[model samples]
Target chain A: MYGGGYIHDDQKKKPEMQAEDPVLLAEFEARIARGEKIEPRDWMPADYRRQLIRMIEQHAHSEIIGALPEGTWITRAPGFRRKLALMAKVQDEVGHAQLLYSAAETLGKSREDMINDLINGKSKYSNVFNYPAKTWADVAVIGFLIDAAAIVNQVANSKGSYGPYCRALERICYEESFHLKQGHSVFVYLATGTPTQRAMVQDALNRWWQPIMHFFGPSDKMSQHTETLMRWKVKMASNDDMRQQFLSMYVPKIWEIGLTLPDPNLKKNPETNQWEFTEPDWNEFYEVIKGNGPCNAERLAVRRASEERGAWVRAALKRADQHYVTPLA
Target chain B: MNIQSLDPRITRLGIDAEEKNPDQTLQREEHWETYQVFHQKKRGEKHSSVGVVHAPNAEMALLFAKEQYARRGETVNLWIVNTRDVLAMNYDDYDVFSTTPEKMYRDPAGYKVNDKIAAYKKAQLDV
Candidate 1:
C-alpha cells in the first residue's frame, strides 16, 4: 500500500552500456514501443533488467517497512471496529510486499536476497516511513494522505512495460481502493470531532507535512539516464509530476475538512497550473535515507529480529528433498 | 542505549539502539520453494493463476495463498502447484504459433459456402 515516486540508482558509477546485439536490442525496443509487455524469459537489454530489479525491489521494501508505524496502532485503535480495520490494513500491506517481491523475482533476484539487503542496510524503502507515527491521528493522516500519494504512483506503474510487475500492481491497486476509503473515513472523523481531536489531527498534519512533500523524492534531474528509463517505461512519471498530482488531488480534501497544511506558500499558480510551495528540506530527506531517521534503526532491528526468531520454525518445516525453483508468472 | 520507543511493546523488547549486528543473509531455500497459486472466484468458475508464494510445502503454500490472494475477494476455492511442476513454453519459442492464425483451413470464419449458394439462387432466377 505504500510506495514513493522515486527509486534510487547507484550514482557512484554510471552503468557501462555494454554493446548488446543490435538486432535483439531493436526488437526489444520495438516491443516496448508497441506497448507489448516484456515477459520473464524475453530477451532484454541488461540495463533494463537491472533498473527494473532495483525499482521493484525498493517498492517491495517500502510496503513491508511502511507497515511498522501503523502496525503500532492496531493494539490501541480507538474501538473494536477500528482495530479490526487497522489489522486488515496492516495484513494487506504485508501481502503487498510479498506480491511485489515475487514480481521482482521474475527479473531474477530472489526474495531472500531482497530481504537480506533490506535488513542489512544495503537497500532503501519509502523515506516517509522513517518518521514516527506519534499518535492515532498520525495513522489517519498516513492512511488518507500517504496512501493517496502512493496510489498516484502505483496507478502509473500498473501501466508499465513489465508484465509481472503490471499484473501485480493491477491487483494491488484494486485492494488499495479500500485502504483509501477506510483511511479517509478515519481522517474525516478525527478532523470533525471534538476540539481536542481536531487539534490532534491538525498537529499531526503539521508534523507530517514535510515528509509528505518529501514522499515523491526531490525533483528529478532530467538526465540521459532518466530519458532512457522513460523510453523503456521504467520511470513512468517524473517525481515532480507525481508530487503535483498528489497535491492537486489531496490538498482540497484536506482544506475541505478545515485542516491546514504546514506550508503557507502552498498554492496553485494560475499561469503554469502547478503547485508551488516552500520546498521540503532535501538535506533532511537524504539524511533520513542514509539511515539516520528517528525510526530507521528500530524498523531494521525489528525486521532483523523477526527473521532471526523465525529461523527455527522455518527450519522445522524444511523438507530434505526440497529444491528451489524460479516462479513462473 | 536501549531504544525507548513510543510504542511500549517495542520498548519492552529492550533492543539495543546502537547494536550493529553482522550482515544477515538467508541461504538458498531458506524460505523454501515457491508455489504458483490458482484462485477460483466462485463455484463452477475455473481457477485462474494469480501469483506465487514461497513456503515449505503445499499446505503452507495454500495457507499463504489464501492470505495473499483471497484477502478481500470472493473465493470459493484455491489450488497450489509447485513451481517446478508446471511446464511452460519459453517466450522465445512463441514464434512457433505465429503462423497458426494464417492457416485459414483451420478457421471457421474461412468458410464461404453461403455466398456461393446465394449466387446460384440468383442465376437460377435469371434463367
Candidate 2:
C-alpha cells in the first residue's frame, strides 16, 4: 500500500529496448487495449516484463520497509486500544509485502533475490521512510497523510493491466481503508485536543510535509520511455497528476482540522483548479535515495540484522526434499 | 557506532550502525517452496484461488495462508497445494476453449424448441 507510483529507473541512459517479435508485441498491446488482464504465463514484451518486475518488486519492498517506521510506534502507542490497532496495522503492512512479492514472483524473480536486493539497498522503496518518526504525533502524520497518499497511488495501480499486481492491489486497498481511518482518528484527536497536543501534531506535519511532497517523486519528464511505459500499462498515472490528486483530496481535510501545512505557498489555484506549491528540493530526494538520509542506514541495518537473526529458524525448518517452483496465479 | 533511534527498542538492539552483511544473500529455496492458496470466504462457497505463500511444509503453508488471505475477510476455510503439483494449461492453449463458447450447442438456452412449436401452430391455423 505504500508504493509511491513513481518508479525510479536509472534512466541516465535509457537502455535500447530488445526487439520482440512484432506480431507477438502487437498481440500483447492489443490484449491490453481490450482491457484484458495479462496473466503470468502470457507472452509479454521484454521491456514490459522488466518494468513490471522492477515496479512490483519495488512496491513489495516499500510495504516491508514501510512497516519499520510505523512499527516504531507500536510499543509506545498511548492506550491499549491504540497499541492493538497499531499492531494490526504493522501486521497488515507486512502481509501486503508478502502479497506484492508473490505478484512480482509471477514475473520470474525468486523471492530470495528480491529480499537480497532490498536489504542490500539495490532497490528503492518509497523515499519517505528515510526520515525518523520522532514522536507519537509523527506516527499520526504518517498514518493519515502518508497512507492517504499511498492510497491514491495504489487505487490507480489496481486498475493496471497486470493481473497479479492488480489482484494484490485490490486486497491491499481493502485493508488500507482501516489504516487511513485509524490514522485520521489519531490525527483528529491530537489536532482537536489541548494546545500542547495541537502543537505536537502541527510540528509533526511541518516535518513530514516536504517528504510527502516528494512522495510521488519529481514531476515525470515526458519522454518516449514514459510514453512506452504508459502504453504498456506499466505506468498508469503520471507522477504530477497523482500528486495533484493527493493534494486535492487530502489538503481540504487537513485544512478543515485547522492544521497548516509547512508550505506557506500551498493553496489551490482557483483559476486553473490545480493546487500549487513551492517545489520540494529534488536534490535532497536524490541524495536520500543515494543512502545519505538520516535513517536509511539504520533501516537497512535493522533489516539485515533481522534476516541474520532469523536464519537459524529458517535453517531448522529446511526440508531435504524441498524444491523451489515459481508461483502460479 | 551503535544505531540511535527515537524508538528505544531499535536503539537497544545495539546493532553496529555500519555493519555490512556481506554474506547475507539467501540461497535458493532458503525461504522454502510456494503453496497456491485457496480460500473459502463462507461455508458452502466454493474455494477460490486467492494467492501463493511460501512455507516449509503443508501445515506451515496453511498457517501462512490464514495470515495472508484471511486476515481481514470472513474466511471459513483455506486450502493449500504445492505449486509444483499443479498442472496448468498454458496461455498458448487458450484457443482450445476459444471455439467452445461459440458452439452454443452445450448451452441449455441453445435448444429453442418453443419457436418451432409456435411456427407449427401458426401453420395449422393458416390451413
Candidate 3:
C-alpha cells in the first residue's frame, strides 16, 4: 500500500546535500521533461534523491506496518477460504514491503535503517493504519476501500520517473488488482449477508469513512512543496485529484451494494465533473500523525515488540563469515 | 493444520522430545531456504526472473510464489530455484561477456535497407 499522501516538510534531520552543478541539474530536468526515467546510477539533484528516499521509505514502511492490521485477522478469518485468502493477501502486503524496500534501497538506504527509523518513530507511514481493525468487517472495509485508494495512488506513481520505483510499482499494481478482487468479494459477501452482517459492514464503513477521506490527505492547495514534486513526477497526482478519482469510481459502487456513506455533502458536481464533499477533519489527521490517535502508541508498541521477538530470526539468518556493514547515507 | 511432521524421528510438532537433542535450539522461520522465482506468462513464452521466496522446500516455495508473484493471472508456470544452488561468475570477469569485434551486421539495421527499399518502391511507382 501507499503512504497517506503526505510529503512531510519536517524530517528530523535533512541531509546537507551539496549543490549540484546547474548545467547538470538542467540536463536532469530536461531528461525528466523528455520522459526519460532516472536510473539508480544516474547523477541527480541532491533534493531529488532526498525527496525520493523519504517518499519511497515512507511507502515501504507503510506496507509493512499496513500489514499488521490485516495480518492480525489471518487466523481468525471465518472459514478456510477466507483464512487462506487473507493469509495470501497479508503475505502479499509483506512482499510489497520487500519490493518497495529494495526499490528504496537502490536510493542508498538499507532496509534495516528504514525499519529502525520506523520503529523509533523517526519516519512515518500511512496514518490510517494507526487506527484499530476492531472486527472482521473492518478487514473487509480496509481490504476493499483502503486497497482501492492505494491502487489509485500506485497506478499514478507507477508511471513516475524513477526506474526502480516504477518497475516495482508495475509489479505491485498488478498484484493489487487481484487483492482488490479478494477484498471486494469479501466486502460483497458481508454486505449481502444477513441483517446482522449487513449492519456489521455498515458500521465498519461508518468508522472507516473519515479515515478513507483522510487517506488522500488534506487538499493539495494546503501543500506548498507539491509544485516542484509534480514537475519531477515524484508526486504524480495531486491529493485532490486522487480523492476525486476514488469518489467518482467507488462512491456509486458502494451505493449499489446497498451501503450508505456517512457523508451528507458527498455529491458529484455536474458542471465541474468534480466531487464535492465535507472537508475531512485535517485536525484529527494531524492528531493521528502526532502519535495521539487511539491506536498510534499501541501500533508502535506492537511493532517494537515484534522486532524484539523477530530479532532471533534475523540473527539466525546472518552468515557467520560476514560482518554487518552499515549502509551509505 | 493438524498434520503430522514429515520427519520420522520428530514429534508431531516437528520438535525432538529428547531434552539433549542439538536440534532444539532457537527455532526461527528465517532458516527457510531462499528460492529464486521465474514465471512464464504463457505456454510458449520464455520464463523470466520475477523475484524470490523463502520456503522450507520446493513445494512450499512454489506455493508461496503463486500468490506472491502470480496472483493476478500473470503467469502460467513458475520455476523455483534454490538460491544456494546458483553458480555465478564474478563481475571482475565481466570482460568475458563481450567480444572484441563489433556485431553490427547482426541487426537488420546494418543492411542499409531503408534507402534501397524506398528507391525500389519509387522506381516501381514511376514505371
User: Using DockQ as the measure, which candidate wins?
Assistant: 2
lDDT of 2 by residue, A1-329 (tens): 79996687886655789999999999999999999999999999988999999999988888888888898888889999999999999899999999999999999999999999989888888899999998999889998989999999999999999999999999999999999999999999999999999999999999999999999989888888899988888889999999999999999999998999888899999999999999999999999998999889888999899888899999999999999899997
- Badly placed stretches (over 4 Å) of model 2 are B124-127
Per-candidate DockQ versus the true complex? Answer: 0.76, 0.86, 0.08
In model 2 chain B, the worst 10-residue window by lDDT is B17-26
Q: Which stretches of candidate 1 lie over 4 Å from their true place?
A: none
Name the lDDT value of residue A162 in candidate 2: 97
TM-scores of all predicted structures? 0.98, 0.98, 0.78
lDDT of 2: 0.92
Model 3 Cα lDDT, one tens digit per residue, B1-127: 2212221211123322221222222223333445678899999999987765655567877998886787666578999887666664543464675763457787665678788899999999999
lDDT of 3: 0.76
Instruction: Please count the clashing residue pairs in each candidate, in the order shown.
Output: 0, 0, 0
Best by lDDT: 2
List the pairs of residues colliding in candidate 3: none
Candidate 3 DockQ category?
incorrect
Between the candidate structures 1 and 3, which one is better when assessed by DockQ? 1
Span of 10 residues, lowest total lDDT, candidate 1 chain A:
A8-17
